[model samples]
Target: MAGRILIVDDVATNRIVLKVKLMAACYEVLQASGGADAIASARIDQPDLILLDQMMPDMDGIAVCKKLKEDPETARIPVIIITADNDNTSKINALRAGADECMSKPLDELCLLARVRSLLRARDMSEELRLRDSTARELGFAETPASFTPSATIAMIAATPVTAMAWKTALGNTLHDKVVVIKKEQALSLTKTQNIPDVFVIACNLAKPDEGLRLMSELRSRPETRYSAVVMVIPKDANNKSATALDLGASDLMIEGFEPQEMALRIKTQIRRKIQADRLRETVRDGLRMAVIDPLTGLYNRRYAMPHLARIADHAKTSGRTYAVMVLDIDRFKAINDTHGHTIGDIVLQEVATRIKDNLRSVDMVARIGGEEFLVVMPDTHLDEARMAAERLCHVIDDRPVILAGDKGNIAVSLSIGVAMGGLHVDVRDVGQLLESADKALYCAKSDGRNQVTFSRTAA
Candidate 1:
């Protein structure tokens, strides 16, 4: 099933109709007869979306939507209110009550399906981010939402200056966002500038229906504007353009001759969604960075290195290819910190990391596993190749002194490397065993001389 959708209506026929339509689209459908049952089903079944009838026997859709929003468990599931009423007041009430969308009795199946797919995509993305956030919280990485303000920047693209100016006036009256009017030639330039719009309103059929569509395509293809929400304005008779816009990644659609109030509401909805998406994206990015990266050295940390070592082990075993694991330690790193201030010590560490990173092949993985220790994994490498690489890295450190800020003279630094080769069935094969071998070699290197490479003895 693509997603699970719950249909809530007191009338059996209404439930059946919606169920059939959704099932035809390969969605798993659930049914609820009234508000009570709807809330119960939403909490227990956790449906991806809910389609609610406006008028019910006991509780109305507006009240039901409020109840759903109040409950934390079901608050995230999107609700679409279906009503026979055409009054703008009804639309306002539904939207205020937390309905994601509102549709009249004679629903356009194309529009309905497009809205459904769009809501499901958004819901899934949010849920995934929420799950990752939960994991991050457990790991003590707390992520906060990005700051948002009512005064956002919105760009409207139209063919004629008159139409664009008119829209700017209407939207400006209703929204706090800074509304800017632009033409096709200037639309692509926004992608290059730092002042990109929070939401893009493209009026299709401005010159031609395809012009706005091509703009939408370009915006979605570009990395800068791909995540920004887009709402397409189409002529009332242009059903084809509406459908194509949705397929081309338009977030919302406005028919020609739409009320200024309704347009304002739609734009507000799109902006809120864009903000939520941006926040979710930032949270997930922060979580991933915390998991893998070392904050001080900007290198992969031990948390990321262990699994990578296992991957190298698995590949070497399966491909019967030789791989090398090296454990490196800075010589007398504590003495450097003890003699010079820790600030200078930090500069030295940063410089050492840069040299180590610069000396390795692109395929090699280097991670800062401890305060002064690093782990390097080289796949498909021979013993001689590993030794040569380690020697070069060692030379890079001892060759030049790290320059410090504040006119401090350069400080000499060196590295002691321990190399262990794997791929033989008889020798240390797994990551744990390989690390043990490398550690012993590292200890031997430190004992023999401060800045030298030592190879581990292979098993029979």
Candidate 2:
């Protein structure tokens, strides 16, 4: 069943049409004939989704949406404005008033359903992220970052209470909204499950030289929260303190009493740098569009796939980030290619690429390195986790049969896999040696009649 939906329209006919559509989609529907009633229904029901009309007699949709957003109880609920006005002014006004999306009136059910689905999905993701943040604070892994916006995901701890508050304030300034005030001096309680926050701020001014040194030591000790972009803010007269922070592991430092504009400019520059870093990460994982991918299967070529293996291995050795590589061969891929020609072979490759991507975690990367060979790289995975992940991929491939327009009535394919633990060899040896170990395991699988995963047992 669809989530609860609230329909707010001044016109009876409009409300009727929306209610019928929602009900048909299995949504529990609530109706409001005007803005005041809509607000009341919103408070009473706290519906998952709202369809609000732009024009009303007493208060327009923008006014209603703004008031809804201002109230804590209603802020999380998504509001999609349904209006006759399609001009720029109305759209801007609607969004400014906190409407999540807009759909023009004389609504098409298909269009309405699509936008509603997207908004609801976004709402679910946001809620999950927020819950994860709260869980992090409770676990004591890291202190929550000050809200630059309520949606900012970074969490960090500081030695001094005052600087902790300032870091949060700076973080709050990072967001588009200034609505929420993150609390002060909360201890870090993040768990391993929490995603490493995007920004980490360590205020050197918060502690004396000795205490700050100890604090930095404690922070750098944690495995789960260490990958974040960390900033250390120091007072002007503390050379010893700043040096300790740098030595202990801080990414950037800012002196206290910098000009206001200077600080703002520096903060913006840091934000840009962080954003660029994220983009670079995506490019690296997805394989740069221009360089690595085969035009047919969305898989990486020789130029793209091995570099990640090498880079990941190097990162593991130098930064203590963990990694594992899995080499896979499509069993009897040649028979299908022989029977159906290159056209079907290309389709099978695309299907295999899709299977690999769909089965792996978002943190994992899978790339087709050859016509019938695929590679999976998983970062921060230990032996047990990597083995289980490979087993999962095997099952995913076993269960799904490729669907294609082919000369044969139907066809099915299977995969042979090999997984190597990073610490066993890759973390200590070079990337080429690491891949060789996994390839040895893959060769063993094919030797043993294919369709299984084998883990390397090399001594570190």
Q: Compose the digit string of candidate 2's lDDT tens values, residues 5-44.
A: 8998889998888888888977778899899998898887
On lDDT, the leading prediction is: 1
Stretch of 10 with least lDDT, candidate 2 = 177-186
Per-candidate clash tally = 0, 14
Instruction: Note the Cα lDDT for every prediction shown.
Output: 0.82, 0.66
Model 1, residue 427: distance off in Å is 37
What digit string (tens of lDDT, one per residue) describes model 1 on residues 316-411? Answer: 665456888999999999999999979888888788888998898755778899989999988767788899999999999999989877787789
TM-score of each: 0.63, 0.42
The collision pairs in model 1 are: none
280, model 1: CA deviation in Å?
2.6
The per-residue C-alpha lDDT of model 2 at residue 291 equals 56
